[model samples]
Target: MATILSLSNVNKNFGALTVSDDVTFDMPEGQALGIIGPNGAGKSTLFNLIGGTLAVSSGTVQFAKQDVTRVPAAERCRMGIARSFQIPHPFVGMSVYENLLVASSFGNSGHHDAKAECRDILDRTGLLPKANRPAGSLTLLERKRLELARALASGPKLLLLDEIAGGLTEAECHELVETIKGIRDSGVSIIWIEHIVHALTAVVERLIVIDFGKIVAEGEPSKVMADPLVQEIYMGISVDDTAA
Candidate 1:
């Protein structure tokens, strides 16, 4: 299992507030890594650091065996790193197909046939039927799917997903889990930051729990979720104190 992305003693801060504290982790090729934590646990901030949306205060970030701590976001995307926002931000005036076309053309370095690539991603994301619809008209789930399609259109080896399962109906979430499973099966590595425990449990081989900007636990999903510290940090005392 070769490493696709590695963070070594990474740290980030905004004024006196520390968001990521010496956090370190690795994603192996073709594996899914789930991140869980309570609110304000810096899960999203960690993604920002990895995707180059924010500068690390200290430490190193390596992608594909190359140091990328100083790489720009666009360069990171071109280097096979792509991410979806926690909030969907589709191009407001653009059609869904057009949105993906832009992602294919620009985000992917204009290296692929934008139309074909866009249609393929839209189909995989279950957005094909709505391809010509205006992005601004989509419902929440559709918006989220479009967000994922945009990222996928970038053709990444490492995909950073931020709560793509959030705000979906149970059936929709299940559908999304299957979609993600297929994506993983295709050999793209993923680091998913999500609060939907069951969704993650179904798709990820491993889990990492973070608290107050630091990793608290990392292991197989069940074991990581059952860890006492993880229960305390994510599920609070109720989970830790519950009877067997």
Candidate 2:
């Protein structure tokens, strides 16, 4: 498979602290990759670097065969990279449909039939019933759906998901996971950073574990999660107690 995204020798430094250190990986086109780590593990920082919300202190970010290390966030969005934040912060005063329209206007750029596009996105994200509801009135799961919908409004080729399953009930997480599976099956590449192991494993083809800005493990989900060191350090459990 062709590579859709690649990070080489990536480093992100804040003053003297290295939040992302020598990170390197390649995402296969149209495949889902999951990232897991404990708190303060620099998972979010890695996402920011890929999504162009933060610049790499040193290294390269190549997406769609183009070097984008210096690209601005909006330019990256237009280049078919779009992401949902860890927290859903939609335009609270706007209706769900309207919020998607706003996102399409900026992120999609020059797309026609915007209404139909957004409507379809709402349906895909399972938010069609709440299309006219104010974003603020929706529940946590609904907000998360809206965030996913808004990212789709941009027509992304690569979607970076940041802790999207956070704070969801089991049933709600299942719903979102199914929706994400639908997206993945439809051939959109994904890199999901999530703490919910089962939810992440359900969708991703491969898993990478990060700690203190470095990847401690990378391989099949079961294999990585079964590593004794990873199990002890990240999950705080010995390998014998549980199997991934």
Compute each candidate's TM-score over C-alphas.
Answer: 0.94, 0.93
* lDDT per residue as tens, model 2, 141-217: 78887889999898889998988888888998998899899999989999999888999999998999898899999
lDDT for each candidate structure: 0.89, 0.90
- C-alpha lDDT of candidate 1 relative to the true structure: 0.89
Compose the digit string of candidate 1's lDDT tens values, residues 1-244: 9999999999999999999999988878999999988778899999999999998999999999999999999889988898999999999799999887776776645554678777888888999999999999999888999889999988889999999998888998999999999999999999999988999999999999888999989999999888877876776633643532
**Model 1 off-target regions past 4 Å?**
109-112, 237-244
Off by over 4 Å in 2: 109-111, 237-244
